[model samples]
Target: MAWMSLLVAGLLEVVWAFSMKQSAGFTRLGPTVVTLVAMLASVALLAWSMRVLPLGTAYTVWTGIGAVGAFAVGVIVLGEPLNPGRVVAAGLIVAGLVLMKLSSAG
Candidate 1:
C-alpha cells in the first residue's frame, strides 16, 4: 500500500531527524551513519509512495507526520520542552493533516 509506505517513510524521517541531532554536525560517526541510512530509506519510500499518491497531498502528509512524530519524540524521549504554545501548534498540524486525509479520501 502506498499509504503504508508513506507512513513508514514519515517515521524514518523522524528517526533521521533525531539522529541528525545526535550526529553533531556529522562529527559523530555512529549517529552520522544512522542518519544517512535513515535519510536514504525515508527518501526511497517517499518516492515509491509518490507513484500512487497525489504529489501535493502526499508531501503534506509526509511532512506533517514527520513534524508531529519528531515533536513527540523530542518531548517524550529527549526531555525537550512542551509548552502550551508548542502543544497548540502541534494540534494545528494534526488538524491540517486530518483535513488533508479527508480531502484525499474523497
Candidate 2:
C-alpha cells in the first residue's frame, strides 16, 4: 500500500512538473492551478507513504520514479532526444533504486 502510494505520488510529481512547464511561470491560470493542485496531492501521498516506509528509501524511490517518468515524458511528448548516455544514466538510476529496495528488505 505504501509502495503504491509512493508510486502514485511519483507519477503525480511528473504530471505536476510537466504542467509547470505549461504554466508559463505561473502566468497561465489553468495550468498554474493544475500544477499547484497536483503538487499538493503528490506531497500528500508522499507523506502518507512515509508512515510505513523508511524516509531515505521512500524519498529515493519517489524522486527516482519522478525523474524516470519525467524523462519519458520529455522523450515521448516533448520529442527530446534519448541518446546513449541518457539511456545509460536512466538505467543506472533504476539500478540504484532497485539496490536500495533490496538492501532495505534485507
> How do all models score by TM-score?
0.95, 0.94
Query: Best candidate, lDDT-wise?
Result: 1
Model 1 reaches what TM-score against the true structure?
A: 0.95
- Give the lDDT of residue 97 in candidate 1: 88
User: lDDT by residue for model 2 over 6-104, one digit each (tens)?
Assistant: 889999999999999889999999999999999999999999999999999999999999898899999999999999999999999999989988887
The sequence of per-residue lDDT tens digits that candidate 1 reaches over residues 1-105 is 998999999999999999999999999999999999999999999999999889988899999999999999999999999999999999999999889888895
How many residue pairs clash per model?
0, 0
Give the TM-score comparing model 2 with the true structure, all chains together.
Answer: 0.94
